[model samples]
Structures are given as C-alpha cells and as structure tokens.
Target: MIQRRLPIASASLLGLAAALSACASGNDLPSADTAASQVTTIGVNSYLWRASLEAVSFAPLLQADSAGGVIVTDWFANPENPAERVKLTVSILDQDLRADALRVAASRQVSQGGGWVDAPVQAATVQKLEDIILTKARELRRQAIAS
Candidate 1:
C-alpha cells in the first residue's frame, strides 16, 4: 500500500513540474513573421504613465521621460501659503499595474526670512498622493479595456 502511494505522489509531482515549466517558457516572438507586432515598448505601464501625467498636470513640469519612466515637477507654491512650496517626483518601476511599481517622492520647502529651508514632509501626504494616482490609473485601464 505504501509503494502504491509513493508512485501516485511521484506522478502528481511530475505533472506539477511539467505545468510550471510550460508556463515559464517564453513566447516565440522573434521569428520574422512576428516582427511587426514586436514594436518597442515604453519602460513603464501605460495606464500608470498616463494617470501620473494627468494627476500632476497642475504643477509646472521640469522633465518627463517615458522611456526612463520618470516625471519631475518644478517647485509649485500654493497661493494660500506663499511662503511654502513643494516639488514632486514620480517614478514608475515596472510595466505592470501594481502598487509596488509606483513610487512618489515630495520635497517641501518653506521660506525662512529670505532663504528657502527644507521642511519635514508628512508620510500621509505621500501615501495619499500615491492612492490618488493608483485610483486614476485603474480608471484609465478600465476605460481602455472597455473600448
């Protein structure tokens, strides 16, 4: 009875391994016939890229590079708080719609008499901005899929 169980377990394990190996195999895309479909791709996920641009459109842009998947903004001063200003950087790390793929950094400065001084930024501010970007990305993706 023990010998019979051993064979069954071995067969099951072999089947699992085969399935995983098949999944790991890459698509045969380099063939001449498939060259047209293999256009160059942007470094980051498309939805996230568009959404990040839209979210920060209010701020003046310093640099935007789709191939590098980075967006840097010029310092923006709030009308209500003329003495404080903030600059934002958005980095997209992967070509997938995942929370870990997006990174948001903010730098805050306040006027100290005549010179601008760096100020400690609240963690919540960064997180909230990330959430907004993610939400917009999801919406954009959904719309794209529907169309």
Candidate 2:
C-alpha cells in the first residue's frame, strides 16, 4: 500500500513539471493577433522602397514584390541609342536606409547582326543609379520626419 502511494506521488510531480514547462513555452511565443499587428507595407525601408519605385518609373516595370523588396525592369532602349538597351534590377536588402542595403545591377545589350548581344555594364553606371536612389530615399525620409 505504501509503495502504491509513492508511485502515485511521483507521477503527480512529473505531470506538474510538464504542465509548467508547457506554459513557459507558450509565454515565449507571440499570439496571432500580435504578429498581425506588426505587419508592414514592405519588408525593407518604406522611404527607400517608394523612392526606388519613383526613380525607376521611367522604365517599364516587369516585376515588383514589396515583401521580397525586389524590383525588376524590362529592357529599355533609348531612341538615341537604338542599338543598345539596358535592363535594371533593384534589390532592397535591409529594413534600414543604408548605402550597403541597396544594390543595383544593370544588364546591357547591343544589337549585333540583328540580334541583341550582352555587353559589359559599366560599374559607374550602377553606382550612379544607386546614389540617385539613395539621395531620393533620404529626402523622402527627411520630409516625412519634418511633417
């Protein structure tokens, strides 16, 4: 009889420990409503995202994903340079509006034998675009803060 009571007491202690641990784990997790409230318009900086779109609006947009913070533009040819065209891809890599968080890649193509051929894109071109976008993003952020 004493042995049976001891086993029951040990089992009860084990169950209580398990229950306390479960409650602790639950406390560490956020509720669904809390997560929903934290959602934003974009994954990266909003000022940078909007400024990037405005800067690239001159070109035809092929894809834009706010969640992924990527913008791809279709090949654009200038009337002055009918033989050469450029395609641009912009990536917003961070939630902060920092220079390292923005990346610009340009693809250049030149007409060769009535077909488009890949050409080396100048590093300066990509850097200039990035600078322009960053400047615009800073300006937008400033305006928002002032207002």
TM, every model: 0.72, 0.72
Q: Write the per-residue lDDT of candidate 2 for residues 49-120, one digit (tens) a residue.
A: 888899889889999998888999999999988999999999998877789988999999999999999999
- List candidate 1 segments past 4 Å from native: 1-40
Q: Candidate 1's residue-wise lDDT over 1-147, tens digit each?
A: 999999999999999999878767877334453222112267678778888999889899999999888999999999999999999999988877888889999999999989999998999999998999999988876775566
Candidate 2 wrong stretches, greater than 4 Å: 1-40
Per-candidate Cα RMSD to the true structure, in Å, reads: 7.1, 10.1
Report the CA-based lDDT of candidate 1 relative to the real structure.
Answer: 0.85
Kindly report which residue pairs in candidate 2 clash with one another.
none
lDDT of 1 at 22: 78
Residue range with the least summed lDDT across 10 consecutive positions in model 2: 30-39
Could you tell me how far off, in angstroms, the CA of residue 20 lies in candidate 1 after the best superposition? 20
